[model samples]
Target: MNRPTLLVSALWLALAATAHAETAADASADANAEANELERIQVTATRSERAIGDVPNTVDVIDRERMETLLVRDLKDLFRYEPGISVGSSFGRFGLGDIRVRGLGGNRVRIQTDGIPVSDAFSIGSFSNANRNFVDLDTLKRVEVVRGPTSSLYGSDALGGVVSFITKDPSDYLEEGKDAYFGFKIGYDSSWDGLFGGATAAFGGERWSGLVAVSHRQGQETENQGEVGGTGSARTQPNPQDLDGRSVLAKLVLETSENQRFKLTVEGNEDDTDTDMLTSRGRQALTGAINDSVIARDHQSRARVSFGHEMDAIDAGFADRLDWQVYRQDSQTTQYTREIRSGLAPPTLRDMREREFDFDQRAYGLQANFGKDFSTGSAQHALSYGLDVSRTETRQKRDGLRTFLVTGATTPVMSPDVFPVRDFPISKTTTAALYVQDEISFADGAFRLIPAVRVDRYELKPQADNIFTEDNPGVALSDISETSVSPKLGAVWHFNEDWSLFGGYSRGFRSPPYNDVNIGFTNAAFGYTAIANPDLKPETSDGLEAGLRFSSAAAYASLSAYYNRYDDFIESMRFIGFNDDGLMVYQSQNIAEAKIYGLEWKAGLELGALSDKWNGWSLRGAAAWSRGEGRGPEEVEVSPGVVEERQVTRNLDTVDPLTATLGIAYDRENWGAELAGRFVGRKDRVSDSSLYQQAGYGVLDLYAHWAFAPGATVNMGVFNLADRKYSEAGDVPLVNGTSTLLDRYTSPGRNFAVSLSVNW
Candidate 1:
């Protein structure tokens, strides 16, 4: 069947099931009691505690229980069933890159852990890449995803959406009348021959509590379903690799009074990987050297220390509740590559090249939030206000050397770049923001109106030292200072107890990134030079969304439609033209406008409501469809010396195709199982005509959990049950022509994962 027909059929089937259940029995009142109880509170949507159904926008929460049941090993697994959101990958070297919401990725989406921003992703050329995969899933208590623009509350870097990760506290583990708790878990995955384990301990006293958690993991290369195995670009199999990672999380809490508390937390994570790059083992036409062997070692680490305070029900003149935190974080990524090549100047001589790239960022941040509840006549109000201030310093450097194997002579020069160079200067970025939001209710709680606004100031300062100046001679550095304002308004009308309609208008903006504003590099061998552009403008988005929701004891369903328009979108590394020196000039510029529209729907039904024979059975499904187009500047030559830049509209390649997921589950008191299917449509809407369009495919997955003992349980999952070969659209690169390496991008086939956990 076609995409539209399949989607319609699924929706019709769900509605039919719900109607049948409603007519079959009178037990609908108690059908989904457990589900209602499990999903109660969320904080990311409004920056305050509120029920998911009460929020005006689309919000999804994945708690610890869900993560465990799904056997989430990484970001990809975490979002496997979530529509309209995906994790981008960097082939097999850098693993996962960033989370894409709607049609935007990279720095457009904001990610935070415990209210602190995570490090940004940076990439230069082919060998150096620093991604935003710093969080360890083992330490998280829950993850919240808010779709659409939320800059009014989060300030910059929220043009698309926000992902908030909340970690576990000591109180979560301490039971009533118990002062201590301990837990441990171990897991294995066949896709990568991976093994992982973790342990957690918590202690509580009269007024003090403490907790410590540690986790470690080791794995081999992730396997693909490729059949060809050989050296050079023809090799479709995965390279040989070894991966190791570990993390530590510790927290201490002090309760001073009935309504006051303080907390101290420390977190650290480290990851290392070694790979034998067999794909690069062929003749290189660019340098005219035969590659014999290539190897790479990558290291990534992050550390953080934070202190926070919280107080409630003070009823002070300024606020009724106050919370604040101060934190310092450091993150770094270092990569080293070694290659041995022959067929150089003389066939008898060989050369060995070694390269190292380092990127680091250190940040200090302070945030304070206050909440107040009051009433004026018939209107009720809940006010939330906050301030955020942060300063970050970023640095990057690349060094390399080539040595002759026989003569042992060393040279500090590579083909495209020289040794000991800096891509952009040592820069510091500072931001300060203040925001206010009010939730007002009228008509006896039937109608709610939310209005919010935020003002932000951003500054970037570049320190050009000897290294940067020597690399790019006669280049002038520049500074950037800008201010932005974001606003949002939303309303919800609950005409009845089980039905509601919600709509919202939100504005978002993102300041120019430091690297994009001041990127300076020279590649004499490639006949191109990248120069800095200080006058680049910030990117902005305006979104409008409306939805209808229905909730009942037996079933729940929601459908939302959204349209977002973006202006002044920044396009990095765009080639303008050849300069006076006959070299191509590349620069980052704001020369694009785009609009994206989509529809998202989710539904669930409890089969037990129909009759006792169908007890312990349920059905759930979700789907999303989006289309986008962008208008960008295109150069046209009218005459010999006359050129014009005209706007040309084309389909956006970043937008994913229609996708849907459906699952049927059965549950008991101590054990449960689920069978799910995921469907993806063909990708034919792309800006580049030469790009390969992937065909539609569907895959099946099975998951189960059983509690063998009181404090022990085992979770298992089997993915791609049919062993079908497929690849995600985003994971596939933009190959300009028919390529033989397409099989390398295929995902793993028929993988199984099993994990065991025990608590005491």
Candidate 2:
């Protein structure tokens, strides 16, 4: 075993041994304290407020305190130490893409902020990409991540899991005796040469309260460990870029009575980027021309307005508590590219191309949830129900112009692509869902049975205007209407005060996306055409998970195993056959079956509970192992002029290899420090042999925090302490052959980040 792996194993053994050595009396006291703490840490990703330990699933919560201590600036940083979870990013161009849970990512994972879903991610070709990085970390109070399928409670996109970001409220900053509060924070990161600052103010009166928070950030391109510099594909260094971002969050709350409250929130986020694509220089495979300059300017923005109501202790015959919200959100992304090419067909001729791509979405939604507690003949029950309704309009456009510098003439027609084309028609999708869940308790809550179900209706309408028809003549569009029913059953048995056994079976499904159903494009120069497929079926999964957990004030541990089976998986842009025009045809289809299974274990220990001499010392460790495979269709040649398709089974490349993390920390009243290490196994279970296989690597990180004065604190961290040159599997693309540009995808070297916060 490697050094990091050995260290993690030793830490887990030490924690288990220490807990075993504790006296019975001490164990009982610690268990009680742990129970109380768990009860206070509530998670809302389940569609209901429940203690983390009470939920029969793998759930992780990152509160503001943890975010501050870790100095998390992006999604990649947020999930650095988390096993079975990772963020995908494109060579610093699109920045962070989306969060992947287990082996699923992209639109399969549901991402929301304050109960409103974020915009979908879309990409076409190499010049256009729209990502789902709309939320600002500085405005969030807490983040909840639910692993595995959870569609029974969250609806369509929860085929993988759910990520919920809850924003801060005025009450959070207002103390009992304080009527008004103000806070400020600043931070810097060496990885991107980034600087950020934010300010927050809250005012509270007898029945009225208000809050406003604003933040701004500026940064350069993210650094990598690449040594080679200059231009062309041979260079490994990061391309030059500038990034600017801003965010604003404002809220107003009114308490009508002790049992009722109302709130209004307005939030906006904007980001701009400019990149010099030095890598694109000296590349001209299509035109055989030397590229002089290639530049890209992109902007992404999102705005949301919501109104919500909360009521408690309502004696109305049906229930006792209620929560509802109505919201509207708009998101847009624009990418523009300007390129100049010299040494064309004529030695003295030069060409210039300007391309623009836009993707926009506007959504209106309403959600209502109710909770009731009642007793049956021999069991107590906690009943929860909710309804969700949402309508979203999605639109996309691509426009470009190619100009001959000598002639001063421009044309919208490029050989491979034409200007002013819509990849898909303007479409509107509406979804309505209703879910109900009940928890039955017996033997004084020692044993509980929970069952839940959700019914969803989805409808899509496409409006193919001139922009769409003009590009793809004689194309037929199809409307989609479908309904899905998902159900789940879970049980939790508290065998003892300090130990529990929990397990559950859940069903998840994802509706066919609009773009996939109505996609249309033609590349005559490439001798290929991509058409829409309206007969696609939704993807479904059956997941089973079980785990044993032990918790105490002094130590905690858990071991979990899960198996998931998926059917009718969607594969986009798969080659089908040749059309009547002798052009290659591609279409999206549901043609895959997959099975994934994994084991996860975590443990933590506090030395203060063992001896006074070891006070303020703690150890924590976690590890995960997973394997997956899928059966899909692959084209094969039967004879010289005949081709056929066959079902093939291969390892799923999305699943990461064995990974583990270990951390040791020392804490005092005013200061604390932690040293953490991460270990990853080699990635070799891939279907494509030509893909780059990353080797096993180990990295260490150090973090520290100090509160030198009242209401003032400083946090700092150094990541990749060994300056190792490594690459995450997700960041590396499949290369056709032995490529010399592999170093370009390596992760950053040693870097530091620091932040300061003050309140008055």
**Candidate 2 lDDT tens digits, 337-375:** 998989886754688989999999999999999989999
| Number of clashes found in candidate 2 | 0
**Which residue runs does candidate 2 get wrong by more than 4 Å?**
1-15, 21-40, 347-349, 523-527, 637-643
Q: Rate the local accuracy (lDDT) of all candidates.
A: 0.88, 0.86
Candidate 1 local lDDT, residue 234: 82
- Estimate candidate 1's alpha-carbon lDDT, on a 0 to 1 scale: 0.88
Candidate 1 structure quality by residue, lDDT tens digits, 1-760: 2654555566567656665665666554445654442235899888889877778888888889889999998999888988899888866577877798898888899999999988889998888999999999999999999899999999889999998989999999998899999999999999999999999999999899999999999999988888888788788888889999999999999999889999999999899999998888889978778899999999999999999999987968889999999999999999999999998887546989999999999999999999998998999999999999999999999999999898889999886667899998999999999999999999987899999999999999999988888888876778999899999998888887766788899999999998889877876678888788889888999999998766667776777889999999998889988988888998999999999988887888787887789888888888988889999988779899998988889898888899889999998889999999998988888887888777789999999999999989999999999999998766887775487778888889999999999999
Clashes of 1: 0
Question: Model 1 Cα RMSD, Å?
Answer: 2.3
TM-score per candidate, chains pooled? 0.96, 0.96
Residue 174 in candidate 2 has what lDDT? 95
